[model samples]
Target chain A: MNAAPGVVAVALVTLATLLIGTWGLRFSRTTSDFFVASRTVRPTLNASAIGGEYLSAASFLGVAGLVLAFGADMLWYPVGWTAGYLALLVLVAAPLRRSGAYTLPDFAEARLGSRGVRAVCSLMVVAVGWLYLLPQFQGAGITLRSTTGAPTWVGPVIVGAVVLANVTSGGMRSITFVQAFQYWLKLTALLVPAVVLLSVWAGDGQPHPVGGDGWSMPLAAGGGQGLYLTYSLIVATFLGTMGLPHVVVRFYTNPDGRAARRTTLVVLALLGLFYLLPPVYGALGRVYAPELAASGRSDALVLELPRIMVDGLAGEVLTGLVTAGAFAAFLSTSSGLSIAVAGVLGQDLIGRVPAGRRLGGVAAFRLGAVLAVIVPCTVALAAPNLGVARAVGLAFAMAASTFCPLLVLGIWWRRLTGPGAVAGMLAGGVCCSVAIGWTLLTPDPSGWADTLMAQPAAWTVPLALVAMIGVSLLTPARVPGGAGRFLARLHAPETLDLDRG
Target chain B: MNTPDPGNPRERVRVTGPPRRRTPSAVRPPIDTETRLGGMYLRSLLREQLRLAAGVLLALAVLVGSLPLVFHLAPGLSSAQVLGLPLPWLLLGVLVYPLLLGLGWVFVRRAERNERDFADLVRGADR
Candidate 1:
């Protein structure tokens, strides 16, 4: 009864991984299976797997906490995340598969016919992947430290080790199964406690969460800064969805364009369903655990609420359930990203040089998995907290800037030369990197520029797209043959997979 | 590395202009109009791709550019009572996602349709 939810969540995650990993063990064998489950994953199953991996620690803990502190505006984070897949489904998914590539770099090289483009794509994938992974470890540390009073590093270390174990064991194949199971586990974890807490809150007179300063609206609300911040969030969520490397890579696991579309639809529904519950927790946190808001770190809303709202055994069990789901959030996302990063590393870095022959296939993936997990885990601890959802928002901005324009131009515009693609990535990367560097390093900036720069995605995606299209127009001669054809494929995925007129 | 299909070589692109020269693929084989599709069909494919690409680009631009406009245009709307719920609740809580979902679905379908049409054109050429 005394054991905290954080401790229980970790245990549940371990059990779920062992069970699902075994279930997937039978299906995984060849390198192809390891990489993409042989591309036969069904829409429904893949949808759940997508949900499992995509619903990160931010979704589980940070978002609800954000809502508790920042009102309904914070809801956009999850909504955008869910909708981003829809963009992927429509724009990139089927064509990506039809391109018949293993990674984003593979697709870039295939489209533009340039190794240099591939190298840049690879580098961006690693960068975005690392940025995205940082929150998972940070959340883990927060969960563990808050629940059990353990050393903060314990959370990230355990998260990294568990993620490494799952990813190295079977690549995407094993991780897919692991993720799908965790999705349900996470849903139940959050929902069950929520239902109980709501019942408890209602029992205690159903008052709204109070304690202002931390829980109410922003200080500069209705001002230029507020307006700019909101719109910037919209842009990042809207465009950034298309560019996340791990998420985009998942579409390749489907059998065809039709399957990819179907998978996206299912993902939208599943994600929408899952997203409905967390904000309720945040709203409830206002009533039950307003102290968290005043003290800062409202991100620990889930961990803190159960004890204040419910005491003794009931609270402990509920906390454990939340912890398990929280752990699932960390594990599924980290594993998915790790697999993507490892695939890129294996094919581009290790495969090209042949030095990694000493570590083959799963072994290589295992070693790569460590890179995928540990670096971010260490960073999560050493670096100052970005606040889970806000940090994730930054990652989205980067993805939108660099990958979103690259994919759109590469897929649709025949005039996109190798030079244009290179130029676009460089411009987007530079702007985004500077913005992020400024945000983290300075944390304070001049008026309009600071607002514009803090939320770079709003303008950066456009800047990159404009640069790409402008440069592309100048060098129509560089447009590759079949550019039209390639675009047709990207837009019309199901047609290729079907035997219709 | 997997060796590319070897059959493409013998046929190479012949530039239609005065150069009238053979276009070569640095490695595998030069891309040629290997199919029997007439010039008219190739022209049609090019036209259709242009139309679709333009539409997709316009849609993305409009979506990205209009954020400031949407909030600014809403009359005396405070942060509350947007479509029954408040603006923040409505936008972030619900409508934005569905809007995004609709747009994303459109993008995927359009992209897929474009792909299928191309594949068909190429297949028809092959036929």
Candidate 2:
């Protein structure tokens, strides 16, 4: 395969990203722009940005791969991911935006008036960010390796550098533009290839995959374990999206609560449209590249399929297009995550310190960006691959288990106290981390125990919620005096003339 | 007697009724959310939004969530073919997206409407 097209495509994408980042830099003058783009982004642009940032390596490359490897049952991944926005839209979007916080920890602090809860939330944000970033780095590594025969380390290093540059220089303002552009790029890349591939398949008589009954049916072989895994996945993705640090931070960019809601509604549509293409790739991969699945290189199915299915210049060009898309996927998501993590780190840990306070907001945030990108990039290089989609799913599960309860209860329940929020977060975070450890350490999981541990969201979310509710009820006196005021601010229309403070 | 005392400030009594006090421009509670009435408004808005959210989620649960169980139980449905593909393939892969988009549209519309209604009520009460 000619590597010229793939290499050139990647170079162009990186250049475009940097140019756009610099362009957006003109608008980013203040700390507000650095953190939340001055909270003035319109619904359509914000929605596109959210879609871009949200669709990481998992949606671009991992979903099709999982579908190829696991067959019909894997469709739930995309479904749950899209529906997760629905969950966000109806439950959290408007209130969170109305909370008038730049970050999740900020919301927690404002809501509970407890630095302790804020500290816990900050830590959770960093944890989730790293967990999410790890897969993106790994996915980039594989994408570059598959496309240009580059060493795996080269990919993570390149991605980390670009993300760090984009994030540190322009912050959220530039990232919004870069991400919005990437969403369309990703959509076109997948859509065009899918159309061509489908036509090719039709010309060849639309031969069905040979996997037969097991591939077509859900839980045909795995039975009870499969059912449990599927349901747990649903619960995680549906709830987890609201809690993702990168995703939640985007809501703060909206002009108001209503725009936030509208942004999310548009996000649902964009994601649904983008998601419709991946299953097409998956189904096509099944028909053309079954050997890739058999060989355990399913993640590369998206990158390799175009070249394999078509011949000559067209094939190489298609390969280049997807490689660019995948690279954009890595860059956009990593940039968003880095900004999110860096924002929290800058505000809570770095900027609060005397030394960092001297460095000031933008400088501290730049340093935080460095700190955020380095750890994950290094770990991704040294650690073994954990299958991009699965690692992402784990991140979702963790988010679902921990922050999901905190956000939901904090927004809706007036009786929620600081101690209750802290306890609930710790309960969910610790248990979910245990499950994550078990799943990662055990090479071969078996039986009900492994199944439960493997996908812990189904149980851990409820555990966290219960702990919060019970503890809050027990410590009713601990509820903040301003709970009613805060709840009013969160739930009320921004147009209404009330003192949100 | 009224016309006779033109000199020496002739008992000029201004009938103003002690500075009529402007009706206080509709005295009402400060709509501060910390107040009980404000809290009640908040609670009502929350309850309405929560109910809307719950309805959407339940509909989603019934429509999409039950698919796995339905497939697991029926098996025949999974095997059934639609346009040269298995039923599960078409439904899970192609159809569910529109369903999700539709549900999202409905939820956004209703949630916004609820907010609009709440705003009207609050303004009405203020008046």
Candidate 3:
């Protein structure tokens, strides 16, 4: 197996990412630019950047793998993933932008006027970011081992290093361009190969995917457990998109409420277009490479299918293209997650410490970025077997449980006090985290516990919402006096000349 | 009644000094009052925005929440062929994305329109 093509593709992507990052760095002069691109990013560009960052290894490789293995049920992942933006568009996008907060914690503190709520939000952001980043690193490892025959650890180290370099040096300004460019690169990588492979499949006679009745049937297994899992997945992905630390952070780049809404709209189209290609790969994989599914390496279906379907040089070239896309997937997502985590850690932990006070804002952010990338890289190396899509789902479940309620209530409900926010977040965080831990530790479980633990969003989300509303209702007087003004600012258009200041 | 005392001078001559009009400055809006009015204005704006958000969410809930029931109730639909692909694959894999994009487009347009209306209201109130 010649590794030259894989190596060259990976190197080219890394170099391009660095070059773009450096180019964007010229525009990042102020702290504000480092954080939110000075809140001046237009809708189209921001949407492209969001799409770039949002479609991680999970979307690129994991979805196709899951689809190939589980069939129609796995389609929920992409559907819910795209529809999550609809939820965001409807619920949080504009007001969250209008709130004028740089980060999730900033929104929390601004809305509730409580340091405790801010701290909880900061913790959740970091938790979600790390959980999401873990999969990217793991997927990278898998991609490298399969593509270049490199050791699994080399991929993570390389990804972590490149992401850290980009994030720490240039921050959001640089990331925006790199990610926007990555969206196109990834789209092309997947699209061109898909077109070629589909033509090949047509030319070779349209053979059907080798599977039984269960493959095409939705909710055909586990009786009620299957139904429960489906809805839980729906709950997670639909609500979870708004809560993702990286995704929500991008909304802050929009110039105003309207721009934020427009950006989300464009992101929906961009994501919708991108998602169409992955399932094509999945369906094609089912036809051409059923053995990969049986061998439990279905995650490599996208990378392997072009080669299996095509012949000789064309196949290798297609493989190289897909390898580049996968590499870009890991780099772009890891960088976005790293930036989100680093921002939180820099502001909440490092920058606030007396020792770190000597370090300037950039230095603190750089230090935070290093810590952010390292923890997940270590975890990916330690626990390498978690399915990429499944891990990403857990991250979504956790977000839906915690930040979803926080954002919704904080924006809409005036009675949301600091204590309520804290209580709700803790309840959701603890429940979801425990379920994730149980799933990780137990390996294979039987009956209801397995279903419930595997997909906890359905219950945990409502619990968090109930807890927040309940606690807030019980302690009405604790509601921040500034809540009214903040809500007003969030809802009012930018053109309004109210004394928000 | 006891004695209209001459020393009292008939209640200090009942001085009539041009009815002592209040200064216009004293009647001007106070800082607290203006803020109170601004708060009211903000509350109305927020109410309108919340209504818009709630309406959109309700529509989405109905659209997406029924998917499971539809598939479960009509199991045959999933296996049915559509354009040489399984119905579930056609619907979830292909058609669902465009639907999502369409929903997003409608929501963004409406939400922005809501904001525009809100801005108009605020501007009108300011005047």
| Order of models, best DockQ first | 2, 3, 1
| Tens digit of per-residue lDDT, candidate 2, span A121-192 | 999999999999999999998999899988889899989989988898899998999999999999998989
Among residues 3 or more apart in sequence or in different chains, the pairs in candidate 3 whose N, CA or C atoms overlap within 3 Å are: none
The digit string of per-residue lDDT tens for model 3 on A1-501 reads 768778988999999999999999999998888888888898898989999999999999999999899988899998899999988988888889988888999999988989989988999999999999999999999999998899999999999999988998899999999999999999999999999999888998988877988887888876688899999999999999999999988999998888888888899899989999998998899888999999999999998888788888988988899999999999999988888899899888998887723667777788889999999999999985789999999999999999999999988888899999999999999999999999998877789988899899999999999999999898989999877767777777766554545
Q: What lDDT score is found at residue A237 in candidate 3?
A: 97
Chain A TM-score (model 2): 0.99
Q: What would the per-residue lDDT of candidate 2 be over residues B12-119, giving only the tens digit for each residue?
A: 765755553333344443456366787788789889999999999999999999999998788789889889878898888888889988998898899889988998
DockQ for each numbered candidate = 0.17, 0.39, 0.31
Greater TM-score among 2 and 3 belongs to: 2
| DockQ, prediction 3 | 0.31
Cα lDDT of model 3 by residue, B39-61, tens digit: 66666656766676677667766
Candidate 3 has an fnat equal to 0.72
A306 in model 2: Cα distance from truth in Å? 0.6
lDDT for B70 in candidate 2 is 94
After superposition, the stretches of candidate 2 with alpha carbons farther than 4 Å from their true spots are A355-357, B1-30
Please estimate how well model 3 matches the true structure, expressed as its whole-model Cα lDDT: 0.87
Return the top candidate by DockQ. Answer: 2
In candidate 3, stretches whose alpha carbon ends up further than 4 angstroms from where it belongs are: B1-44
